[model samples]
Target chain A: MEIAQSLQQVKSSYIREILAAASDKNVISLAGGLPDEKTFPIDLMKPTLENLANMPEVFQYGSTAGYGPLLSFLNGYFQLPETHTAMITTGSQQGLDLIARAYVNPGDKVVMEAPSYLGAMQVFGLVQANIVTVSQTEFGPNLEELEQCFAEQKPKMFYAVPDFHNPTGVCWALETRQKVAELCIQYNVAFIEDAPYRELRFSGEALPLVSDFCPQNSIVLRSFSKIASPGLRIGVVTGKTSYLEPLIKIKQGADLHSSVPMQALLHGLLQHNNFATHITTICELYKSRYDVMYAELEKQLPASCVLKPVDGGMFVWVEIPECDTFELAKSLLANGVAVVPSPVFYPEGSAVKAALRLNFTNATPEELTVAVTRLADVLNAL
Target chain B: MEIAQSLQQVKSSYIREILAAASDKNVISLAGGLPDEKTFPIDLMKPTLENLANMPEVFQYGSTAGYGPLLSFLNGYFQLPETHTAMITTGSQQGLDLIARAYVNPGDKVVMEAPSYLGAMQVFGLVQANIVTVSQTEFGPNLEELEQCFAEQKPKMFYAVPDFHNPTGVCWALETRQKVAELCIQYNVAFIEDAPYRELRFSGEALPLVSDFCPQNSIVLRSFSKIASPGLRIGVVTGKTSYLEPLIKIKQGADLHSSVPMQALLHGLLQHNNFATHITTICELYKSRYDVMYAELEKQLPASCVLKPVDGGMFVWVEIPECDTFELAKSLLANGVAVVPSPVFYPEGSAVKAALRLNFTNATPEELTVAVTRLADVLNAL
Candidate 1:
């Protein structure tokens, strides 16, 4: 069959595919970056449904930009009163897809941190953008490498997960964030700050969004998936009005709008409950799980294995020296455990293969301990 | 400030934009192709939500292909037991968008009816496809013109709403569907069967889908929005396994997946309730509303105005001689009525300008009567 040339270049989302394959009842899966379902505020949803049922228009199609009330609430929640415009999306993933569709013409240049979120990279790939990657530093993306990539590639946009960055689980320091914002302004490149994990921070005080510093040129994507329910599929995009208007137009042609009932439910939850406090509870839960997983990995894993403690977010990044993570993942799965190989997160055929991402949020403490022991056994056998 | 060249060619959805503008309290809107809110099975949804509450997984991130039970239900409902694959989408609109992204490369040829669904046209435009429009007949798209288009353009695909075709409200006869399917197969052109309005038929038995006639190369998109609840935003696409597999991959990259709670609610509604019987009741309700609007148009419209009595679907297409629908729609709005200008439904700068699409489904009988009378007044003044 003659597939589109662009599709020939496009690969299936690795994390999603691996998670699907390993979702058996016995597997202690760490492949999916899923939020803890146990922490979902089920009691709050009852009142939310009641509120939606009361509103007659809740069942009707909403504005393409989003439900106006939800957008207003998001704007206030983000505390961007003056220069920001917010639009709701199906999820933060859709926000990235919309931005890709709007700004990326075929063969356009887009830069991102190496080993960034696989989903965002998949979106950029679909648009046939030429992806340039900068190395990941302990703080955030390597500033010098980014500057060099910017000068050489002159990319149209830079995509980042500055808040508790995915896979690496390293949040950008306030200084690094300020520097990146200034560089985006200097280079005339658009910045897409994906902050889906910002609210999940457990250790440090939350830093101001990159958008707060570079108000005119950056867009920040936030989702309720981490806090409330991923099943609701609600997210918000906040940015300068000029960029947001175009995104709204793209969204109109995408799905017309996100699910209205879900939007109404989210609005109801926000209005009626202390959603912020609930998110805090979720953070504490994940923090304890992260600690458990980190401690178990240290006690059980081989001396060659290095584990990075996740300050926030769902994943703990692990590096295995001189070992194929993919093979280790398969052996771990055979032993009733699942972990995602990080090589799939890089560009296709890239040289990064020794890293793996293990999710700490989905499994229980006992399960995490068992999974780590199983992983250690697999590593030792290899 | 610089818009993409692709966006320059893409216009806002005429129905959605006009409907938003006509949301004034005084405006008796007959422009939106939205299903009646009163017809929404709200009573059923309460129990459905209760069922969802019992299933903890309903609030978690579901499979990218869909919620498994919903896909299984759809497969059984559509009778695609063999040689078929199904995936859930945000809506049928998103399905079309995915097909466009996956199949239609720049300058790829695509075919549509002369006055087709505006949303599909907008998607094709965004993909930079060269669109060729075939004329329309009462039965459906003109088979002779479609044959000619296939011969001349060799389009990559043809998009059609064979069942109660939008704006025109014309159902394709069985013979027409078979002939069109045969031609597509002969030319190896993909057929996109959009059947959102299929279940809304007021009378006459349902015709077999084009996919039934030619399963090897056709994709069928069905939506629960019209019959059940648009607020849930659940829709499905079924087609040959070969083609659908790639589309499912594209969908995974697009939005991760549709809402899990929405799909769970739909699955519950389908399993626990007599949805077919509910749809029959809805058809009866729409039939009466359709008759009321038809009679009112006959009595109140200008002598020069021509209206084709539609068997099903929400809209009534009307042509007023020597009157531009854009101007007339503005005049009608001033007179506290709303209708969509027909030109917006056509390809860019098409010659079809003197027609309007008045929706009878969304308005009450009294509201329809008053709106039609006001429309007549506007036509008379013009």
Candidate 2:
């Protein structure tokens, strides 16, 4: 059977290839956006795991919207307004895919930063959306360019990782969030707020979500993969009832619903008294690793290379002097350090930037230091 | 924002509405295809649930194909050829959905029996497939009509529930299965054999899967929902590696992978020594319920209402004198029993046979008796 034309255009993830290669025992891999396995709140989840046997209801088919108790808990936990609702997804990845399937027609315009989440690009690409990109500033998307694209393209939605942008790690400033929300409302565009790393803030004060300023005109996707467990594959999508209903309909066809036992386990973990402390612990641990990597890069990297300090999240973006970054990545991999090339994050055919996204979350402080030393040595030779 | 044009044509499940009404305390509902909650084998899963906390690797990200151990176990368990591979889906529903999204282009021809799975129709509808329906016989599909449709439309695939079919509960005759497989191979049409109810048989001897006749030309979907648990939402799809790779690509964007911890739990449960006994216990329980429902329908329904005894499956289709089944279902619900209308099963605007689908698995024998009496009373009045 011939594959769907829509699927033909989607390239298999390049990062997956790099991650596969980086898994060798000799490599100090930073190629994947994975959280450390050790930080999983398994102890906090023990009660739920033990109690699942007592809850016979979860073993039966559940509501397509979500496990009802989990949705109710999230409503109160997220402090959703009466007009808003929460629906659980297989993961936030499914949430994004549903949004695209529900709302994005082939050739429909979808805006995103050039350097954005690779997963988001893959989802939108599968739907055949005409992705429009705006350059990014330290604060957020370039407002002038964003406004021009919105006016010109009349895109259906603006997809973003506003908490700490993927590949770049730039959280949108308060003013930027408010302005982006205003633009979305003014242009009748939905703001798709993907907040997978929102709780990973280790240094700076948290800013309000872009959707907070335009609640009726936005959809928010929250992932548990970072703070809780990726293996559980549970995520939440919240928006006004009207915005979320179509996604629920699409989701019904997509997977019926996510796993009910996983939802119950997540609910139990969230309600635990120490869940907040658990998040803080992972954040601090990640911050220490990030500090070690950043300091090492500052000390050893060639003067031609430029790096930025990330307040939080998994990655630090380093701008290398212009060269063949893919070849550079291959050379670094052979030297026992793994990092992602920048091109994978951009829409296909977009201008390629010479950079690498270095993840600090999964590695130990010592590994992070050694990996940076290896990375700098390769760059100095180049 | 307006929904995608593809989604605009798809209807939200009418069975869902009937199911909502069915949940009333006073109603004896046969509206949902749910297994008996008592048969979930929580005891079999308990050991795994407790052990999940100790399996930290399961809490991290897993391969998109499936958890490694589960895939390995299924390989030997199913006796898959080296050329074939198995991938875990969120559910068998997801396997069907992935096949549609990965292969069916807009206006591409997809063939099914006139009265087929409602969820299958919805998934194909969402992809804008030009669905062609062949008439179904008690044994299986009308062979002449199926071949004619295949030759005329040249559909991308033929989707079916070969074992005990949904609603009708008509298990295909052994001869029909072999002929269908031959027809599929001759026409170069992919056979999508969805065998969710395959293992539910309590009396009949198990037959080889239709795929066994044309392994290279088929994709098989197997579900644990009927025998194990639905809330876990784990299903397996197996086919030639070439046929399944597209599905895996679609699944990565659908949800990175299904819940890995759920995958691990399912793996452990499948490996337990008592798991075979657990399946036998549920089969016996469901068989008892089916017998009660079948007897009650035979004793209570008017002669004008036709009933066929089923060897296994959750439902029994009752054909009534030509009338509006939707209205009949509403009346039955008003009389404190709920069932699915026949029109919802057929493709929209097709000539629908006046019938009702009554589930026997979830309800008790007493409720089955009461529900049938109510159903008879209403039909006799009509």
Candidate 3:
């Protein structure tokens, strides 16, 4: 059967494909943007599930928007004033899919940071949107390039990670965020800020969301996957009332709503448990792990290897000049260490072939030491 | 902001709008395709949640295809004698959406029943498919018209409900299923047989699905929502190996997968409890409610009212000649009763508008009796 022409353009995430082929006994996987399972609030979750089981209405069909109490809880969490609205989604991924369906038409232009999260690019591609990419600097997305893309494409929307951005672990400075907000206002383009890892910061005080700078044209996406459990599939979208209303409609047309029982479980966890305290402990744990991984890299890697210290988020981006990250990844897999090539995080067939992303969160200190030693051996052999 | 052009072609479900506006306290809602909350296997579910709570792994990220045990269980359910592959989805709604994204391209020909489930129509619209509707008869879709459509349009696929079909309550006879399967095979068109209500048959032995007749060209969808709980949002799809591979990729790209915790809960329910026995009791309860509604309609409806007996399923189709069903629905809503006008289910906006769909599953016998009496009175006044 002839499939959708748009599907011809849909490419699988290269990292995911490589991770799938690696053996559990040998592979030290850093290919997936996965949270450390050890930090999952299982103790809190058990009681939460018990509470949900006791609530008779929790097991039935919920409103197409979400469970009311959960939505109310999210509204409080996001600190949205009475004027703004919030809706819970299956995950941040579903939030991205809903935004695409709601706002993007065929041939409509959508702007994104050049090496942004691959999942969002796949979704925009499925919607048949003409994608325009802007380069990213250590501070954030290149402001000049962003303005140029906005001026040239007049994109229907701009999707970005404003805080502790994925793959790069670079947060947008407050000034850069302000400039982006002003540009959105100037161009009348919607700004979609996805901040799934905001709460995972190890050291600095959190920055204000880009949405706070331009509330009228911004939508902020938050996920419990990084802090709680991805299995529960809990996420929320906060934005202006006008945008949220249509997103709710698109969500209704998607999967009716996110899992109601899961929402109830999450609500119980938030209300009854010391969720903030739990997340603080998790951040400390990840911070220690990141320190261990950083030390291992310094001790074991070649002097030519260069990496920017990740302030927050799960991954550390490493650049090995003139070496193919994909080939290096395969060699590491053979040596029992798994790391994702950087190109998977970029648009299909991008030129960022010399970089690789390593995740420190999912591995233990001993494992990280051994993995880094093996990775150094692979690089030396190359 | 300009929304997607495809959305302009997508019509919001009229039934959803009516249900939203009508007061819950006074309204006898027949507009929702909802299962009886009273009949939900609550006892079975409590233990299921307990079992899931005992296993923390259930609360972590699962394979994109789905949880392994649930997929294996569904494969057994569908492919008893021979092995087949199955993928879990958010709901049967997501199943339709994935199929649309994977198969339909702009202006691609797709066939559906004239007065079909509105959700399916919404999905096809998103993909910009040229939808052709085949008239539905008492036994099933008019095979003659379907063949004519196939000959003329060379449609890529035909979507239908063969068992306890929505609104119409018509199950395709065994012979009709075979003939439709043969025709689809001959024309090399895919068949999507959605069987959400198959387990809810009040009487009669189960007829084999169209996929049973033409295994190579059919994809069968089954859901735990109608039988268990829609809040959990778990559904399964089974088809040939060739088709299953691409769908696995599509499901991965869509939302990673459905909720893992829900899949675990469902697996516990299926294994540890008499779920089939519970469904039997629920079906009998709905059958009683169906009888009560039919008796009330026979006694109180105007002489001009045309009614069709529903053997099983949630709805009853009623036609009132020379009166617009939409206007009648409004009058019924004013009188504190709700029904979905049939025109909303049709593809063409200008199609027949004299019928209304009444659901008998969600209300008690006394409530249904009172609601139908009020409905009859409103029709007489109209």
Best by TM-score: 2
Ten consecutive residues with minimal summed lDDT in candidate 2 chain B? B343-352
lDDT, residue B142, candidate 1:
82
Give residue A194's lDDT in candidate 1 (0 to 100): 92
Error of 2 at B278 (Å): 1.4
lDDT of 1 by residue, B1-382 (tens): 3566778777666676677779899999988888998888777677876556567788898888899988888888888958888999998889998888888888998899878898898888898988888888888888887888899888899999998888888889899989998998999999999999989989788889987888888998988889988878788999978888888888777788999989888888887557778898899999999999999899988888888888788888887786556777778888999888878878875557478888888888999888888888878766
Per-residue alpha-carbon lDDT of model 2 for A1-382, expressed as tens digits?
7899999998998998999999999999998999999999999999999999999999899999999888999999999999999999999999999999999999999999989898899889989999999999999999999999999999999999998889899988999999999999999999999999999999989899999999999999999999999998999999999999999898888889899999999999999999999999999999999889899999999999889898899999999999988999999999999999998888987888899999999988889888999998999898
Q: Write the residue-wise lDDT of candidate 1 on A1-382 in tens digits.
A: 3677778887776676678777798888988888878888877777766555566687777788888788888778778757678898988889999888888887888888888788888888888888888888878889998888788788898999998888889889888989899999988888999988888889978888887778888888888898888988888888888888878888877888999888988888887657778888898899888889899899988888777666798888888877667777788888988888878778764558487788888889898998888888888777
Using TM-score as the yardstick, the better of models 1 and 2 is: 2
DockQ of each: 0.64, 0.92, 0.70
TM-score (0 to 1) for chain B of model 2: 0.99
How high is the DockQ of candidate 1? 0.64
**Residue-by-residue lDDT tens digits, candidate 3, A324-361:** 66777777888888888777777754456477788888
In candidate 2 the C-alpha lDDT for residue A199 amounts to 97
Q: Indicate the worst ten consecutive residues by lDDT in candidate 1 chain B.
A: B45-54
* TM-scores, all models, native as reference: 0.97, 0.99, 0.97
Lowest summed lDDT across 10 adjacent residues in model 1 chain A is found at A47-56
